[model samples]
Structure formats: structure tokens, C-alpha cells
Target: MPKSKRNRPVTLSKTRKKGREHKEAIVNSIKQALEDYSSAYVFTFENMRNLKLKEFREQLKSSSRFFLGSNKVMQVSLGRSVADEAKPGIHKLSKFLRGDAGLFFTNLEKEEVQRLFEEFEEHDFARTGCMATEKVELKEGPLEQFSHEMEPFLRKQGLPVRLNKGVIELVSDYVVCEEGQPLSPESARTLRLLGIKMATFRLQLVCRWSPDDFEAYREGLDLSDVESS
Candidate 1:
């Protein structure tokens, strides 16, 4: 039987890099989207939630494509200057891709895209380390909202909770969270249990680019920022 070369020794090199081919693929994909769509916009997001973003993507999947990845790859795809730009006036968007932003390619009319981006928002329970949007308190009384079985859990969450006659009771007024303060792990979990949503996920449109026109909708990103960089 011939000796099989299945057990080959692999190099344990420490210095290795990726994205030569991956970057090429991304560049191609962005170019294809540009060719298919009439307009492109740079959008920045806050309090990102993947599930919510997934739902939003489904809503516009038929008419739009969203790209969220390395800023470097995206910038390269759109080009850095007028000389090398994949599409005319698109390099302007590359200027605002400096932070928590993404590229959106869409076939929908400009008015429709503006409306959707303006109205799109999602609320979710705040997490630990997130600033509390408002103070959350519990009064000294029976907590009819929670079952008696939740007394231990509530107590563990730093709440003055007890179980009396199969009812969850708040023995004293307690503050689970305070406005402008970062939420603790216990407080975050407690807020979720109480069905309080304090975090908002939103995307802000920064600028729009097309074959014949370019406009920036937000301030703070301009040609000065581009020149300074």
C-alpha cells in the first residue's frame, strides 16, 4: 500500500496575516452593490443589538444591502480619493467610516430611505456597565407583579424582598438603579426580570452619495476632518 501523506507537520508560525483574498472578495462585493444600487449612504449606530439589526435587515433585504465590517476593507472598497474611487463621489463616505459606522447600498428612492432610517429604533433591556436611563424603584408593599417564588432571586438582586403568605413583598423602598449611574450586573438582571427596557438601539444617517450628487446630513464630519486625517 502506498504511504498516505495525511499526517503532515503544520508550521507553528507566530506571524501570519489574513484578508488578502478576503479583502478582494469584499471589494468585489461592494463594487457589485454599487453597480446594482443607485445610492449609497454612510450610517453610524448606537447601542447595537444583533437580533434587532437582523430584524431590520430582513425588513429591507429586498431593496437594500447593508455592509458592516472592517473600516479598512470598506474604505478600500469605496476608494480613498477621486482618482481611485470605485464610484464617483463615494470617497466622501469613506471619511465618516472612522467610527461605529457601516455602508448601506440601496435601490429604494432617497425619500423612502431617509424616512426608514429616521424612524428606525429598537428598545432593549440595559446591560451591566450601561448607564441607567431612569431611576427604577420598588415601594414597600406586595409585589403582585412577581410570584412568591421570585423572592430569593429578588433578594439576591440586592432588593429588600421577602415572601409572606405565598406573595412576594418588598419589605422597604429600594432603588434597583439610579439615573446617570452605570447599572450593576444584579441590577441589569433585575431590570430585565421587571420588564424594563432602558437601552435604545438607533442608527443615524451621516451622508448620502450618488452618481450625480453628494450630501452630508450630519455635522462633525466634513472635508476638514478628511484633510486633517
Candidate 2:
């Protein structure tokens, strides 16, 4: 009788198992992040390297803010409905998570969030090597189309417009304002003229919280009313 042929059964490798565990851990952390955070802003870092990334993290740490992991992890943790509600109208961000993706989590004052975002914008603008790939791009056409709607606000803010190569520029410097805080009539007008819009995320405010408000503040508020209210 011929000997019977047999095949060895394959066993799972430790390395593969470990990798799977690690991924699951990351996913769980992402889920926790979504559950705990009241607000989050998704951002992608372009050309950001060691020192710059450290500085950025330090800045956020100083303000009690933190960035969570990738969008897939976040989505897995948050589920579609919660994640969609968190960012509202900014679904475009979902596509841009291919790069160094993160979500800025904070329970800080709304103005602080706005201020942080503005600071991030300024930092990106100032950095020669960094670029914003996912930012909201304002085209000349929109500016021109809305100029009539924007002019009154600009005039009220006492900001003059300069025709720079056929583009309008705000003539006056404006200060950042938080939710419920009053903006100088001129500043409000200037903000309007500049075509600033409401944050797509419900948790995101246009301004930071004032130190004074920090003394008794209990919750966050809409930042869109910064100019009007």
C-alpha cells in the first residue's frame, strides 16, 4: 500500500497577530476620542517635518488641545453619523486625509478654537515650505460676486478697499473676536467684507474665549454671532 500523503496546517504568525492587535487598539482609541471630544477639526499637514511638527504640537498642548489619529480610525471609532455631524458641511475634508491626518480635539472656549485655527492659518502662511492643500480656497470671482453684499459691512467697519491688481484688500487691521463678544462696528464690517464665513463644524467657533469669560464659562457657544452679537 502506498503511504498516504499529508499537508501541514498553517498557523497564524505572532507578528501578524501583533499588527492586527495594534491596529485594533488604534481604532479603539479613535473611538474613545470621538466619544470624549465635544468638537474636533480635521487637518492635514503638508511638508511638515520634525521640528515644525513638534512646534505645532507644543502650541496645541499649551492651549489644552490635542490631535487624534487618522480619519479611518476616527471614522471607525465615531461611526458615520457622529462623524458627519461633528464636521457638518465640510465633507470635503474626508477626501484629504491621505496625508498626515489629524483631528484637533478641544473643550476650550470657542474663541480659543477659532484663534487656534487662525493661528494655524497664519503659521501655514508664514512657513515657506508648508502649504495648505485642504483649505477653503477663495477665488477672485466669489469676492467680486459678493463685493456688493460685502461693501456695506466693509464700509461700516471703516475699512477701505484698495484695488490691488483688480482685487480688493482690507485697508485696516482687525482683531479676533470670540462668540457673544462685541466686535468694533468697523471690525465687524471688515470681517464681513473679507468674506469670512461660518465654520462648517458646529463645534468650531470663529473666535477664542476671552480670559474674562474663562472665569465663569460653563459651555461653548456659536462663534458666528461674534460680529452681530
Candidate 3:
């Protein structure tokens, strides 16, 4: 003698609903690049510097394209298995699509591509959570780099300092940051104020593909080297 239960409605997860459209766009763009470019590459990046990457893209704007997105979608665009591979053997490249990976499509010769990636680099201020490359100790004296007006700001960043005769002076020696330790917010600010740049932005070519062949690439890859089946 129990009453009938009412039907319940279900809500879809937000990520599933939002990600579909974005994934489709990426797939289309990747497929287009694969079709139009004579050569393709798989790349991974570290400590990405957006402005530097933007400039890099601008440099290659006329001759090449770069795609950064989910590796799963990229693998799907290239075909995850041999039977459905986008190109004759493109499925092989799918295995390399891991980490902060992306696709680079261009018509440039292999040597030129290798050279461009090697020479392209930019240095920037380190951020919080980045490991300090070296220890920094500030001597107890007038810090000429900052003005008297900045004394208060520096103190808030945990530095023991003051103003003297329109100059910012340190009351005692300060350990700004330690090598191999993750940078803290205060330490990063102090390093920036002291003009210490500890981050280098660069691109590395992992592998490349041509219609006739494919190969793994590394810094100083000789023109004679090749890897494909």
C-alpha cells in the first residue's frame, strides 16, 4: 500500500556541456592545419610567457600556425588509432601528445625551424611557486634601486628597511630568496623590485612530420638525421 513515486529530473555537469563546443573548434582548427601545411610538429613548453609566445607567433604569422589545447582532442583530430588516422601514418604522432603540448604547422624547412626555436628566448620576472635559480642576499645599506617613497611598500613585503636622506636603506641584511626553494609572493616582489629576472621563456621542437617522412627533433639536430618507418 505505498504511494507512487514522482519522476526526478537530472542536471548535466557544467564541464561536459561547456567543453563540447570548445573541443569541436579545436578539432576543426587542427584538422585544417594538418591539411594546409606541408610540415607539422609536436611541441611542449615550460613556464610559458604569454607575451613572448605572442611575439613568437607574430614572427611566424605569415608562414606558420600554432595550436595549444587538450591533448585528447588533438589526438582525436590526428586519429587515435591506425585504422582512423587522419593521414597515412599520423596515428604515430598521437602517442607524443602529452603534457603542455601543442601542434605547430608550417612550410619552413627543417633546418630553419630548428634554428628559430633555438634562438627564440625571453627572460622575465619569476612568479610565486617558481623555484629560485639562485640565492639572493641584500646587503644592509642604502638600496639605490628604490626611492624613499617605496620604503613602506618594501616593509610590507617583509623587508626591514627605512628612508634616509630621500633614499631607501635596509636596516639589516635580508635573505630575499633561497636557491631551489619555491618563490613566495614577498620574495617575487622583492626580486622584481631589485631587477632580478629568473625566468626564461623558450620553445622546444619535439618532433616533426613531412608527407614523405617523420622524425624526432632536438637541439642541434643534424641535417643528416632522420627517424621514421
List the RMSD of every prediction in angstroms.
6.6, 19.4, 6.7
lDDT of 3 by residue, 30-69 (tens): 8898888898898888789888888899989899999887
Rate residue 141 of model 2 by lDDT. 28
- Writing each residue's lDDT as its tens digit, candidate 1 over 102-178 gives 99999998899999998999999999999999999888999999887788888888888778899988889999999
TM-score for all models, in order of appearance: 0.84, 0.37, 0.84
How high is the CA lDDT of each candidate model? 0.89, 0.44, 0.86
If ranked by lDDT, best first, what sequence of candidates would result? 1, 3, 2
Native-to-model Cα distance after best TM-score fit, residue 42 in candidate 1, in Å: 0.5
Q: How does model 2 score by TM-score?
A: 0.37
Tell me the TM-score of model 3.
0.84
- Between which residue pairs do clashes occur in model 2? 111-207, 111-208, 111-209, 112-208, 112-209, 153-189, 157-186
lDDT for model 3 comes to 0.86
